[model samples]
Target: MRCPFCGHEETQVKDSRPSEDGAAIRRRRMCPACEGRFTTFERVQLRELTILKRSGRRTPFDRDKLARSISIAIRKRPIEPERVERMISAIVRQLESMGETELPSSTIGELVMKHLKQLDDVAYVRYASVYRDFRETQDFARFLGEEGLNEVLARER
Candidate 1:
């Protein structure tokens, strides 16, 4: 690794450890010339995946965009951030395992809804309303009824 302090071409790793989240490795480095120490992180980059939009457009898969959508749906909810990250990772893993370079937008939406349904019913409904493009109040009612959320909501009364 290059030294950041002196812009030297060579640096030695002094220590290495897994990050707190276990998602990456933190490495402590030292510059031989300036004796300056610095830290760097390393993470794995999986094979590139593509998203096939409804418009027939293909775009590179974005984990942050996926996280933002889920976060918006679960906003103000009780779900933890770690859980959300795990969910996104699981979804990405599943997509990658399919051995397909491109996947339909609807398939991705279904996967998100499936996971959200288990995480939080309200969040699930909130996401479904947008994903399915609910047109009226009855659409919400029907979805709640079909998902047995009506009964779940009743118990909270």
Candidate 2:
């Protein structure tokens, strides 16, 4: 690595140790020319994630927005906030680990639906109503259709 202080192209690593977080390596270096020393952090490059929206627009991936949406779904519910955060993080990690730079928004929505479905039915329906845009009674009916007909009918009665 180039010496930050001496502007020299060569530097010797005087000491190397693992960072406390273990996410990166902490390296102490000495410049041969100016004898000025400096420290550097090194980490592997992660691939950038791209989101292909339904509107045909491509955007950089964002975790905060996903968390916001999930939080909104579970707002005032019995579910724990940290649980929602963990679900969002799990979904993001799954997508990032796929080794793909680009992903469809539908894929993200499906992940959220699958996770929220497992967490709470109210949250799942809340998220689905916003994402799927149930415009009419029929639309909601069809969405509810995906659930077990016997269970829903039993709930009604």
Candidate 3:
């Protein structure tokens, strides 16, 4: 691997192990030229998946982007980081096993909604506010009512 610190051509792996969730291989490396150390994660990609957007534009699926979106939704929530990581891995694995190279963006959003709904109600609402393009407060009320979460949210408040 290339050294990110000094732009060195090579780095030596000092240790390797499976990630806590067993979805990726975590490697500890050191750059000989700069004596800098860093960690890298390697994951198995079953295939190259593409996302077909609503705008008719196609783009490669990005795990980081998905994680970031989820992170935003769960920020300051009581959820654990490990749970979020596992959820993201599960979503990616499900997409890969779908046997289709190209999938609609809506499919991914729906998967995220499904997982988020099970993970946390607050996070689920946060994500839905954006995914469903909520224009006003009534949109949230409508969604909560539609999902039968009105009573639950009222109890929390």
Candidate 4:
């Protein structure tokens, strides 16, 4: 592998092991030219997937982008990082197992919303506000009421 630190042509792997979640392989490497050490993760891609956007545009599916969006929703919401990672892995696995090369963006969004609802209400609302494009306070009220979450929120207080 190419060394990220000094742009060396090759690096030696000092150690290799499965990650905590077992979704990826973690490798520790050292660059001979600069002796810089860094960690890398390798994941298996079952196939190349494409995202069918709402606007009739197709784009390659990006795991990092999905992780970033979930991170934004769960930021400071008391959810464990390992749980978030597993959630992401589960979502990806579900998508891949569907046996389709292309999938609607809504599918991914709904999956996220579903998982967030089970994970945390605040994170769910945070993601829904953006995904559903809430325009006013009434939107949240309507959503909470429609989803029968107001009672849950009230009970918590």
lDDT of each residue in 5-103, candidate 4, tens digit only:
889999999999998899999999999999999999999999999999999999999999999999999898778899999899999999999999999
lDDT of 3 at 100: 100
Angstrom error of the Cα, residue 77, model 3: value is: 0.5
* Residue pairs with backbone overlap in model 1: none
Q: State the TM-score for model 4.
A: 0.95
Each prediction's number of clashing residue pairs: 0, 0, 0, 0
Model 3: residues with Cα > 4 Å off, grouped in runs: none
- Per-residue lDDT, model 1, residue 153, is 69
Candidate 1 vs candidate 4: the TM-score winner is 4
lDDT of 2 by residue, 18-133 (tens): 76645458899999999998999775436788999999999998877888888898887788765775676678778888889999999999999999988987778788889998
The true-structure Cα RMSD of candidate 1 reads 4.5
- What C-alpha lDDT do the candidate models reach, one value each? 0.87, 0.82, 0.97, 0.93
Best by lDDT: 3
Instruction: Compute the lDDT for candidate 4.
Output: 0.93
Residue pairs with colliding backbones in model 3 are: none
Model 1, 33-150: lDDT tens per residue? Answer: 9999999978665678899999999999887898889999999988888788778777877877888888998888999999998898888989999999999999999988888889
lDDT for residue 75 in candidate 2, whole number 0-100: 87
Task: Work out how many backbone clashes candidate 1 has.
Answer: 0
Model 2 scores worst on lDDT over the 10 consecutive residues at 148-157
